[model samples]
Target: MADLKKTELEERAFETAKTLLAKYQNPHNLKLEENSNLEDCYTILITLLYAEILEETEQLAILSIIDGMKLLDGNR
Candidate 1:
């Protein structure tokens, strides 16, 4: 709802997204934060998105991310 406070929604969504993304990230990868691969960074971004839209359909999120990534790829 548009009436909801921005912080409340963001916090809830971020928490939701993080929980789902946490399922895939390997703890050992945290050892080399600066050298983390793009895949790992993507995972983190997706997790952040998830936490923001915890109740969102995964298909929609995946599709959105795929489209967004394509735009980034084009910049290269």
Candidate 2:
């Protein structure tokens, strides 16, 4: 399989985050800021309502989170 360029990866992350954000009822009408970096965007989304956000993102989020955990665990 071909590797994705940085831009392609970032774009995919942005789209996935946007789709996840849309699932929230968002009483505050929170929006992902254009000026914020990807990490910040993800932080806001995940922190807003952790479990719900994870649930909304579903399989992709689960796999990514597990992968991240493994990386962190290995690094420790």
Candidate 3:
């Protein structure tokens, strides 16, 4: 049961990331140089897009807080 839930969550995250990548990579939205390598562009774009999403969602902030708490506890 837990495994099924984890799998579903993973799938949803993957689909969301794919959608984000497609949106950023849409030729109509993004202009590139003729010599640009699309594969490299995509790799960079996806990393940036995911980081944007994490920041926008405040997930990164929450994770940072959690890590801070762990560090403080460990020092005690």
Candidate 4:
């Protein structure tokens, strides 16, 4: 049950990351190939997130999203 919940949370985080990345990319005119690595996208996302002024909740969410990404990478 716990694992299922964790997986669901991770999926949500991943979706959030994807949505944010798309929004960021569009405004900046950044382009990524179809085969771009997840870790590379994660790095760019984190860097961009840190560049902005975010609330504590928003920061925590991004940290959790990054952790979720790392776990997906089998780093956790």
Using all chains and alpha carbons, the TM-scores for the candidates as numbered come to: 0.35, 0.48, 0.30, 0.45
Best lDDT goes to which candidate? 4
Which regions of candidate 4 deviate over 4 angstroms? 1-11, 18-27, 30-44
Report the lDDT tens digits of candidate 2 across residue range 38-72.
Answer: 56555544555454635544646535644554565
lDDT of 1 by residue, 1-76 (tens): 4564433323433443444556545433422243344455456655445544444465465556556557767989
Residue-wise C-alpha lDDT for candidate 3, range 9-75, written one tens digit per residue: 2333344445455555454344333333434344434554555544455444334434544565699
By TM-score, the best candidate is 2
Q: Point out the worst 10-residue segment of candidate 2 by lDDT.
A: 4-13
Counting clashing residue pairs in each candidate, in order, gives: 6, 0, 0, 0
lDDT minimum window of 10 residues, candidate 1: 26-35
Pairs in steric clash, model 3: none
By lDDT, the better pick of 2 and 3 is 2
The local distance difference test score of model 4 is: 0.59
Off by over 4 Å in 2: 1-6, 27-29, 48-59, 62-76
For model 3, what is the error of residue 21's alpha carbon versus the real structure, in angstroms, after optimal superposition?
Answer: 0.8
C-alpha RMSD of candidate 2: 5.9
Deviation from native of the Cα of residue 50 in model 2, angstroms: 1.2
| Clash list (residue pairs), candidate 2 | none
